[model samples]
Every structure is written in C-alpha cells, then in structure tokens.
Target: MTQISAGERDRADTLASRRDKFILPDGVIYLDGNSLGPVSHTAISRINHAVTHEWAAGLVRSWNSAGWMDLPITLGNRLAPLIGAPADTVIVTDTLTILIAKLLANALALRPDRHVIVTDSDNFHSDFYIADGVAAATRRDITVRRTTRAALAEALDDDVAVVLLTHVDYRTGELLDMADMSALVHAHGALMIWDLAHSTGAVPLHVHEHGADFAAGCGYKYLNGGPGAPAFAYVAPQWLDSLTNFLPGWLGHARPFDFEPTFEKAPGIRALVTSSPSVVGLSALAGALDVFEGISLDVLRRKSLALTDFFITEVEERLPGVFELVTPREHHRRASQVSWRHDEAYGIVQALIARGVIGDFRAPNIARFGFTPLYLSFRDVDVAVSHLVEVMHHREYDDPAFRQKNPVT
Candidate 1:
C-alpha cells in the first residue's frame, strides 16, 4: 500500500479554515457528529448573547423588543437555503418525534379517505413510534404500516395516507433516492415525509427540488447545534395553504395576540408552529447556522466523500476480513457516515473513546462514525483509523471494563 500524507491533503483543503471556527477538545478526534456535533465559536457566542442580554436584561419585554417570538420562522429562513427549500417554506419547531406525529396526522386530514400510514421497517425507531401514536390518536381510524426499503415502492395502496421514511438509514449509513421514492409515493396519492436527521448538514439536500410533501430533521447533528436543540420542518409550497397543524397552539393562531375564543390558524408554515418556541435552543441553533452562511453543501459533500472513502480504503488495505462494511461504497448511495459490523462492536467503540477517538455504537452489532466537513479534515480521519488499527491489533478492546454498556451508547 502507498503511504498517504494526510497533512498535505489537509493543507490543500479549502475548508480547513472552517475547522478553527469549532472548539474541538485537545488530543481528541471527534467522529460522532451524526449523534451530536461539536460546538462552534459562533453558536457559543450566540447563546451567551441570548442569555446575558436577551433573557437576562430584557425579561418580558424581550418577547417583542428582542424578537423572541419570531425565532422559529426567522431562524428557519436562515436554514432554508442549505436544505434547498424555498423562503418561508421551513419552520424550526419541536422535536423530530413531535413533528413526525404532527405531519403524519395532518397527512390523514389531507387524505380523508386513506386509512393507513406506510413507513420503512428500517426507519429510526422513534419515527415508527410517533407514526403509531398518530394512528392511535385517530381511534384506530388509521393503521400504521411498515415495509422494508426494498419493498417500500410496492407497499403503497389506496388506504395509505402517508409514507414516512428516513432519508438515510441511521444504523447502516445507507442513503435512498429521495426524488424517486417521493415521486413513487405521490403517484399512489399518498403524502411523503422524510426524516433527515443524518443527512441534513453533511449531505446536499434539495427537499423542494425532490417534491417531498414534508421534511423534518434534527439540529444537534451536522448543524453543530448543542444537545436537545430545536428541530426544523418543511412544507411544500402547494401544501402550505391546505395543510393544518395537528397540534395547534396560540402562536399558530391567525391573531395570537387577539385572544379570540375561536381557533383561527395563521397563514403559511406559521400554522405548523406548536406552543412557545425553545428560545435558548432556537438561539443556539440559529447561531449554528452561521457556520454554513457562505458554505456550499456541494463542496462539503465532496470533502465528506473523500474522507469516508479514505477511511474505507485504509481499513480494507490494512485489516482485510476484520469487519463487515455496513455503509454503501457508492457515493450517491452513502450518507456522511460509515459503520462496520463486528461481534465486539460495542467494545471497539468504548476502546476508541478511551483513546480519545470518539465514535458511537448502535444496538446489536454496528459501530458508527460520522463525518462533518465543516470542522473535520483528512488528518482527523487518518488519526482515527490509526487508533482503530491499534485497538484491534493490540487487543486494547479486550479490557473487561469496556464490556459494561452505558445507558446512552
């Protein structure tokens, strides 16, 4: 195998300067951005301003004076371009689970005649749970249907009101063709909803371009928002007018301040807003979007593919037959992460974390690693693989302490 110079590749990287914007810990290589991204100077600074000035000084007046009420839509507009959504089409709001339930319920309203909601069997577990909850809320008027990704295309029937799927498989890091899948669902008169938690920031997304009826994603992952940060949702232009919020709040009222007795929903995506926004979380998320201001998803994707490809190539060359590659090798079919299946995957992940290389373990037998182009470099990837090589050959993961599983993993 030819020796690779990660230093040289990093030095030539145009996004190298973006790394300085983040505050990565010393001597640690972070490879779990898919779970939670590291903090950026911009996000920290923004959060501090919100605490010190907006909330502390302004108090109640801040709702109007500090523009606290508009963070959901305002911040969402900032996130719109990155996801290839039109202005005013996206709104930052509750957790992905809540958004899924709200969107799934609203889909039933759209297709009053339909009685089923179809989703992939491999979708994030929470998504399936939310869909079931939505179905149950209808007094069994609706049924939650599950199908494998390979079989999803043929599963839609007249009773299917919505088809919910994760754009990228959480455990395997496999990406699906958004345009083709969404189109297929529409042909059968069912709404399409996508959970983009894994691909929102690292992969190039075109929600509107792909004709998805609704899309939602988390901010804590590739967006670099802190933990429990607010999530975002997008509604297609055509649906913005006809859609109804399943969980409505005062803020979604046409005249929330009017204090009218009857419920009158606000126009456009604002109708999707439920309850008061998470001011601090939204503030941090808005701050995180600052990092992607002028950055192109296309450029980020190029670097991401390069990093993952390098890691895969090095692993195959050095440790043949050691682990089963779970992520797809094809660029178009891959997300911004990689995973490998091993009998001792949990131990390997713990061992890597003990050595300052942070990755996460998925249930059963998969070890996952995420790549964020905004703050990571070729050198980071190179070092992480080196640690894995040592951990495997030196049997560092054999320590009994690593066998104890944590609650969060």
Candidate 2:
C-alpha cells in the first residue's frame, strides 16, 4: 500500500514506448479496454485501405482478387495461436450471441436425448439469454448453476449436455481453470462451450490442449477491432463433419458462390461461418493483431500482473476505506482489470473520466479499470492512482450532476 515515486513511474513510462502503435488521446489513461479497446494506428490505416482501395475501387472483384472473402478463415488462423486452437478450427464471424446460439444448437443436435444445457448463473448476460432461447426453441431445460469452481464441478452431472461458462468473470475479473473444468465436464459426458470474451487477449489460453469443444469471443474488446467488431468462434475439428450449422445460410454452404438449391455444409472452418465477413472491421482487426506478431503472451501476462498489482497497492495506500476491492487479490485468479465496490461508483467513474483518467462503471456499485499492456504503462497506472486519490480526498466524486447513466458502460 505504498505510492510509487515519480522517478520510478517515469522509468515505467519509458518501458511503454511501444504504445506508440495506438492512437490514444493525450493526458488520458484509458482503463476500459476490457469493454472496447482504443483504435490502433495500424488498424486505422488498414481500414482506410480497405475502404478506399478494396471497397470503393475494387468493388466485387475484391472478394476474390483482393482476398476479401478469405478474411474470416484467414484471420481465424492468425488468431488460432492466441487462443491455443488448431489452424482451420476457428472462424471470425457473427456476434458472440449468434455464435453461442449456433454452437448450442449444434451441440444439442449431437445429443438429442439430453435435455439440459448446464451453465453458470454468473456467466455473462448474453450467454444466459441465449441459453434461455435454446431452452424455448428446443423444448429443452436449461440448468444454471450459480456457484464457485467447487460447486460447478458437482453441478456437471450426466444430464448436462453442454457446460457453458465464461473464462473470466466480466464483473469481478475472476479467471477459471479451463483445464480442470474441461476434465470435469468430460467426466460428466458433457461438451464445454467457453466464452472467451475476457480471456482471448488478456490471458494465455489453449482450447485444444484443454479439450474445449466450442468457444466464442468479441473482437472489439481485446482484439481492438473498433466498435461492433466481428466476433470469432472455435469449433473442435473433430466436430467438423458431424456438427450441424443451425443457421446454414448460403455463406456456409459447400459451394456458396455456386448458389445451390440444397443447404450443403462447407468443409472445415468454412462450415462454421454463417454470412459474408465484415471486411472493414476484419481488416482493422487483422492489422491490430499484427502488433502482436512476435510478442510473447508470457511477457504480456507479466506486465499485466505488474500493472494491476501496482494499481491496487497504490490505491490502498492513498484512498483507504473509500472503496473495497471486488477483483481477486490472487494473481492467478485474476484477469487484466481491477474492480472496487463503492456506493457512488457511477459518479466516481464520471469524475475520473472528467479528469482524463477514463475507466468505466459496472452495475450495482463496481468501478472497473482495465490495463492493456500494449498501450498502458506503469506511469499511467501511477497517474491514475493519483487522480483517484485526489477525487476521493478532495470530495470531487460527490457530485450529483455527474451521475447520469451511460449506455455503453
């Protein structure tokens, strides 16, 4: 609980020299990358080229000549290493909700006799909502178990057809043991569909190595594909021929361009796709991923841990009793963010943003701060803590006018 010195902070800032790749605003310490990442310079340029050259000039030919059509699977291949999935097993496509529904239906098709879709009650709202739809559509029961890892293990019974869970808790940044949970699910004869929204870029993952049957995640959050970026899905290659596509649109047909009369599933990752790729967004994502071409997740994890640990310690030293930590203290059980429970979380978040230290607010009283190793520095974390201390001690967060609700928190 000690404040790091300005000299030490300066050294940390120097270490963040590589952050020049991002187009961050001056004097702003962005700590909401967990929700939507800041646009990178490379992403911007890539989008520009796609817009001007690929779309405007090339037009329809771009789909083949410019390789616009191959982006979904191509980008998926690029993303494979990040998620620890084999090549041709992942595909950049529709939103996580849509992908979840498709994968859930596909899994249900495989187990016609099973009626229960097991998931954690604390899983992200979208996942729960989709599970509800699956129940209604198939006349199957959805069993939501709101419990800890230990309890979850007990909940995975033979009746469970699929075990759905988020790799990291969106609210508290709590991480789950994928390997352990997969083993438990397999023992119960259930398939696992992991929501990698908070795990993909924040931590190292090995879906195939851990035997994950299915997975989905957002592109905008950690992949930095801008708002409404195309999400990706991972289906084990073993299910390539057997798994059915609930939304077997022309894009997923064996010969999409052929415009066949019957719905024939395409082979490999192509079969998982549902529609035309988002060229602009995918272009941006492809360029954004280039920033990590040779980067090691080990180095990224080390920096992430240092940043979160530094913020927590400095906050405790400067603003004790003002807020209570909601995120886990154990490094292994944590993600890339830190959260604190406070009565005036919304107002505090607004005040922090006004001061140019832009974090975010979650529901019910949680102030969240995300630290992206690519753009955030130790100095930024130090400055953010200083601003936080000022807001609390100077009563700057007591404003009644700044408490208006925002749609995109």
Which one wins on TM-score? 1
lDDT of each: 0.90, 0.85
Q: Specify the highest-lDDT model's number.
A: 1
Residue-by-residue lDDT tens digits, candidate 1, 239-290: 9898798788899999999999988899999999979988999989988889
Model 1, residue pairs in steric clash: none
Task: For residue 146, give model 1's deviation from the true position in Å.
Answer: 0.8
RMSD of every candidate to native, in Å, equals 1.1, 1.8
Once fitted onto the true fold, the runs of candidate 1 whose alpha carbons sit more than 4 angstroms away are: 2-4
Q: What would the TM-score be for candidate 1 when compared with the true structure? A: 0.98
Report the lDDT of model 2 for residue 48: 94
